[model samples]
Target chain A: MTSETTPKSLRTIPREKAFYFFTSIGNYTGLSASSLKDFLEKINQVNIKSLEFHLNRGDFEKWLNEVLEDKKLAEQLGRLQRSNLSGDILRSQLYEIVSRHYKELTTRAAFSM
Target chain B: MKLKNNTIALDATDYKILEALREDARQTYTDIGEQLGIAHSTVYDRIKRMEQYGIIKQYTTIVDAEKAGAKKITAIMTIYTEPKESEKVAEKLCKAPEILEVYTSLSEELQIIAKITAENQESLHTFIANSIAPLPGVLRIRTSILTKKFKENAFSIVSDPKKITFIKETRNIERRETV
Candidate 1:
């Protein structure tokens, strides 16, 4: 199988899972999406979401609320908050959200944290 | 001073105060008032209210990396460790100064993701290799650094969409499961 099709690569991370994953990555690395694309890409290639579960251990929800205070993105995310989605879609959306506002939503040192 | 968590209501002025702080935290209340066309006292009041409501947290200075002569290395450190020792390992990492941030990822296949900052790449490497890698319970570590500085700043996602959304809905994707 190609790298993309491997079990580790092909598995899907649902929205909730993706939320945890991206948030953890953010908290740990201080990296917003644009800065950490290479890192995400590497993790993506491996088809693993270990980064999502472990790093988001602090007061992340509150921090998320503060940092991602975009009413619009919050609204869009709210629509999916209770609604369940697949892991892959969620992962993509997480990356999209970060990539979209990466330049703006993060500090210079955020990713390297 | 007392620290109380005040969860209360907010208004347009409160939002404006937050917006100002987000842009430049060092702006004086007088400067803020000049920009907002309000009295400095009014700006102070609004800011206090926002802080009371937990809307505005702390103010900080934004440092320019190029001018500071600090090397910015952004990496995703994937760690491998035994299942039982996860918490212990994470705790140990929390104490390490060079290891600024650590995240336990959902992709359990990799134990942790870390971001490191140092005066130079050599210090960063030494920190990761000698300091981080040698820690007990750490099995393997892989790292990648920023090749080019793209952009670093925060933007309001609610107000802007055209600028924020890049990966469209059609991309094929995958998710790594926890081990």
Candidate 2:
């Protein structure tokens, strides 16, 4: 099914759950050293209510593409469209995926250096 | 009065002094001392120590902006910034006359949260567009207009004795419920 046809339940991003996901990504990404620190910082600063509204309305991926101009990241986030997962579980899964991507990037950077 | 190196440890007497001063910063040390039954010199000493410890930043008047013919439209703006530019951006925003407070948020999507004030919505829009948007490293800004203000720095250092009693009674009720 198209992303547009995705159920509302799949799109829900709760505040505390979102907060956990964002903060985990921020910490793992190492804000002081990572190149995407600003991008992550921006994500961290968005009000919880605003983030919830955007995610609930399914504008999150669009916002990432348009504002952040990170289509790959947006597309990666788009993978979190499973209808069966509960909100908390979905958030945890999203956090794991993003954290893994950053972890790999961190390892690559360490190896390159 | 004994000083705790740099940071002064406040006691009941210190809290009473703070409460008195908060009520009226203009109140004389003598008046505060009289009210609290302490020596004026002791009150002065406590205040001086508190200031040194940065507990008391500055003494300033709280103005009724609307009554003073300066109506303000306040909005909370969430800002995204480039890596390590959040501090610089926050500092720049703070320097602007229209911005009231800039706070760093722990969220991943936002870098800073700034409270801005303008005479009207048009001015607020213009300031955000012209001044804030142009700041280097500022990636995005989302504003939410404040509708009502219930409290502004309303917490008291000195707790009301009645409230403390009420809290104790409530705790007993909560304990009973848990039991």
Clashes of each: 39, 14
Predicted structure 2: clash tally: 14
Most TM-score-accurate candidate? 2
The runs of at least 3 residues in candidate 1 whose Cα sits more than 4 Å from the true structure, single-residue gaps closed, are A1-113, B1-6, B9-12, B33-39, B50-55, B71-74, B80-84, B108-110, B119-122, B155-179
TM-score of each: 0.44, 0.52
Top model number, DockQ: 2
* RMSD in Å for model 1: 24.8
For residues A5-96, what per-residue lDDT tens digits would candidate 2 score against the true structure? 53222233322122221121011111111123332443444344433433543444654564435466567766564333434555555456
Cα lDDT tens digits, model 2, B1-179, are: 34666556666677788788888999999999998888999999889988888888889899878689887888888878886788898988889888888899877665788888887866775566556665667666667788788888734775465665676689899999999
Listed per prediction, chain B TM-scores read: 0.63, 0.78
Q: lDDT of model 2 at residue A57?
A: 39
Q: CA lDDT of B175 in candidate 2?
A: 100
Candidate 2 has an lDDT of 0.61
lDDT of 1 at A18: 25
